[model samples]
Target: MTAPETVVPTGKSGIYMPRRSLLMRIADMRAWLFLVVLIAFFEVWSRSAYGVSFILNTYNLQSISVFATAPLLLALGQTFVIISAGIDLSLGFVMGLASVIAAHVANYAALQLGLPPLAAMLVGMLTGIAMTIIPGLVNGWLIAHLKVPPFIGTLGMYGVARGAAYLFAGGMTISVSNSWYSTIGNGRVLGIPVLVILVAIACLIMHYLLSQTRFGQHTYAMGASQAAARRAGINVKKLTMKIYLLSGIMAGVAGVLYTGRFSAGAAQAGEPLLLDSIAAVVIGGASLFGGSGTILGTVAGALVIAVIQYGLVFINVEPFWQFIAVGTVIIISVLVDQTQRRFTGGRQVE
Candidate 1:
C-alpha cells in the first residue's frame, strides 16, 4: 500500500498559523502592552500621591475626559493622514480658524439675522466645517497636483491658517452669547460627559472606517509602498486629497467643541493641541513612517497624556516641568518606534 498521503495546509491557512502564535501576537501588540504598563504605573502613582479615593473618583475620570477629548479627536484625524504616509501640520491652526469663524458667524447669525440659538449654532458648525475644508482642499492641491511635499505644503497652510484666524478675530477673542453653544462642550448624557461621548463615538466610527472600508485598505497600501499602490491601480492623488480633507474636517469639529467648552474663540486657542495631538499619535504606537495606527491606541495615548498631566498637577509639579516631561515622552516614543522598525526590517506594528 502506498504511504498515507500527507496533506499540508497551503495558501491562506499556511500563512496565518505561524503569525497566530502567542509570541507573535504579543510582539504585534507591544504598543498596547506599553499602554497598559503606563496606565498601571499612573494608577499607582496617582493613588500614592493623591490618595486612592481621589484617584478612583468619578470626578477625576470626568476631568481626564475633558482634558483628553480635543487631543483624542485631533490624533484620530492625524491617524488617517499618517497611515497614508502624509502629515497635516496645519491641524492646530485650522482648528483655531474654524473656532474663530464659527464663533463670529454664529454670533452674527443669532444677533443680526435674528436666528434661533440652535439655528445659529448650526450655521456656525457649517461655517467651521467649510472654513476648515477649504484649507484642506488647498493643501491637497499643493501636495497632490502641484507636487509639493506634504511637510512644506501643510507647514505653509499652518502659517496661513493661523494668520487667517487672527485676521478673522481681529486678534481678539470672539465670545459666544448663546447658551446652546455650550451644550456640546459642557452637557452630559446618561451621566457621561458630552465631550467623552463624542470622543467615544468618533473612535468607533474611525475604527470602523479604518478596519472595514476600501478606503482604509487603499490607505494602508499607499503607505506600505506608494509605487506598488500606483501599479495596483490606486488613484494616489485623489486619495491623498480626500485624506487631508477628512483631517481638516475633524479639526473643524474639534474647533467647534473648543468654542463650546470656552464660550469663546481665540486665534491661538488651538496652538497647544499641535504638540499634544502629535504626541498622542506617536505614543499610541503609530509609526512616524506611517502604514500603521489604531484609533483605540490613540485614545489610550490621549488618556495617558491626560492622566500624566493631571497627576503632575495633583502632585504639585510646576507647569514648565509638564512640557519637559511630555517632550521627553515623545522622544522616547520615537526611539521605540525606530527600534521596532529596525528589528522588524521596517515592518510596522499594526
Candidate 2:
C-alpha cells in the first residue's frame, strides 16, 4: 500500500520556483490586480468632474462597494464548483433561505421569552448549514450516482430551492426585530463595511482550501477525470458530495450576510446572483469544462462585475441598461475562455 501524493514543495528565493507554483502565483496576482485596477479606475472616474457625476457621490460609492462584497462571495464559491467540473445554480436560492434563517433567529419565540442571543444566532447558522447540505447532497447524488449532467441537475435544483425559500418564509419579507441583529449586518469595522471584510475572509479560507488542502487536491483530480481519479483510489462520490456541500455552506453564509445588510428576508433574495456568480467564476479563469481555476480568479471576476455595474450607475446610465452591460461582460469573459481552450487544445494536438 502507498500513500497518495497531494502536494509538492517549491523552494523559495534562492531556489528556482516550480512551474506549477509560478502559474498559481500568477493566477493569484492576476485576480488581485484585476480588483485593484477596477477600484482605481472608478476612483479616478469619480474625480473626473466630467465623466460621471454619480460616481463622485460618496454615498453611492460606499453603497456600490458594500453591495459588491456580497456577490463577490458568491463568485468565490462558484469558482470552486466550476474548477472541479461542476456548476451550482442554487447559490442564489440557498442564500435566500439563509437570509430567512438569520431573520427568524432573533424573532424566535424562545428567544423572545428571554433565551440568550448567542444561542439564537448559533441556531440560525445551523439551520443555514442544513439548508445548504440537502441541495449539495442531491447535486452529488444526481451527478455522481445517476450520471446526470451537471448543468441540468443544478438548474433543476435552482428552481426547487427558490420555491423552498418562498415556502420557508411564507412568501413575505421577514425582518429581524432586534437591534443586535441589525448591528451585525449594517456595522463597519475600522471604517470598512463588515460584509466586505467577511468576503475577504471567505476568499482567503477558500483559496487555502483549494490550493493547499487534500480535499482540494482530489477536487482537481476528479475534475480532470473521474475514471482516472477513481483508478487513483480517490473517492469520487465522497468528494463530489463534499464539493457541493461546500458550495451550499458558502451560499448560506452569503445569504445570512445579505439578510443582515438588507435588514429583511425575501424570496427574491438572490435572483440576480445566479448568472453573476457564474460570470465571476468564468471571469476568474475557471473553465466550464472543469479542471482549472483559482479562488483569486473568482474574486477578481466578481470585482470586475461589481465595477461594471457601479460604473454604469455612476455614468447615469438608465437602470435597464445594467443588464445589457452585464450580459456584455459575461459574453466577453466566456469568449476569452473559449479562445484559450481552442489555442491550448490545438497545441496539444500538434
Candidate 3:
C-alpha cells in the first residue's frame, strides 16, 4: 500500500507528506483477511460442534482445493476482464460447450479412429480448446469492433454457447473411457491434485501478466478511462479483443478439466459455476466499476468460497446456505471497495 508520496509545500519550510494510513493498508489485504476469518470460523465451528479439527484434517484441505479448482480457473480470466472494466457472461456456457465437445471428440478418436487412449485424450483436449476460439473471436468482434456493450455481447453469447453445448451433447451426458484424461483430473503428485497444480501454474502466469507486463498496464489504463487510454495511444479495441479471447480460453480449459474429472460431459457442467467465478473476482478485491484487482487476490477469493462450500457440507449445513454465504461476502467486498474508494477520493491504489 506504500504508493509514491505527494509532497506539498508547508509555510514553515517543511514538507507535508501524505501517506496511506494503516486502515488503507489493511483494506488492500481484505481478501486475505476474509479468507483467514472464514477458515478460523470453520475451524472453531468444527471443534466446538463436532469435537473435530477442520484445518488440521488433511482430507478437508484436499477437498477444499478440489472444490476450488474449476471456479478458480474461471475466475483467473475474469480478474483480467474486470480489470479492463468488462465482464464475460458467456464463460460458463463456453466451458460447458468445451466439455461436451471434448467428450464427443475423445470418444470418436478412440472408438471410431482407433487411436490410443492417451492420444485420443490429447486430441480431444486440444480440439475442445480450439473450438472455444470461435466464440472468443465472435465475442471480440462484437464488443471490440462492432462496439457492442460487454454485458449485452457476452450475455447473448452465453445463450448461443449454452444451446450449442446441448445440441452437440444430444441433450445427454457423454462418457469418456480414457483413464489418462481422468487421471489428469483426479490424480495427484506429491499429495497435491493435478488440477490444483495446473491452476497454480496458470495463476502464476496470469499474475505475472497483470503485474509485470505492458499489457497489464494497458488494461488498467483502458479500464480507468478508455478515452484517456486512446489519447495516450493505447489500442483499446485490440486490448478488448484480447481480454475477451483470454476469458474464453480460460473457460475452455475449465470445461476440458471438468470432463476429465467427471469422466462425462453434460451441457450444464458449468452452470452453477458462473456465479462462483464472478463472486471470486469481486471478493478478491476487484472493483466492479473498473481498473483494480490481482490474480493473487482472486486466488484468496476462490479459496474463501471453496472453504465456505466444503466447510458447510462438512458441518452438515443445508447446501442452499452456501449461496447466501457467498452472496453476503460479495456484498461486503463491494461495500468495502466503495468505502475505500471514497476515502481515497476515487483513486485506485495499486
Clashing pairs in 2: 284-297
Worst lDDT run of 10 residues, candidate 3, spans 6-15
Identify the candidate with maximal TM-score.
Answer: 3
Q: Which stretches of candidate 1 lie over 4 Å from their true place?
A: 1-24, 27-31, 346-350
**1 versus 3: better lDDT goes to:** 3
Model 3, position 222, has a per-residue lDDT of 88
Predicted candidate 1 versus true structure: per-residue lDDT over 204-310, tens digit per residue: 99889888998888988888888888999999899889888888988998998889889998778779987788888877777777788777778777777887787
lDDT of 3 by residue, 21-66 (tens): 9999899899999999999998999999999999998778888998
After superposition, candidate 3 runs with Cα above 4 Å error = 1-16, 348-350
User: What number of clashing residue pairs does each candidate have, in the order they appear?
Assistant: 0, 1, 0
All candidates: CA RMSD (Å)? 4.1, 6.5, 4.5
lDDT by residue for model 2 over 194-268, one digit each (tens)? 777777788899999999998888898877777889999998888887888888888888787777777787667
TM-scores of the models, in the order given:
0.90, 0.83, 0.95
Clashing pairs in 3: none
lDDT of 1: 0.82
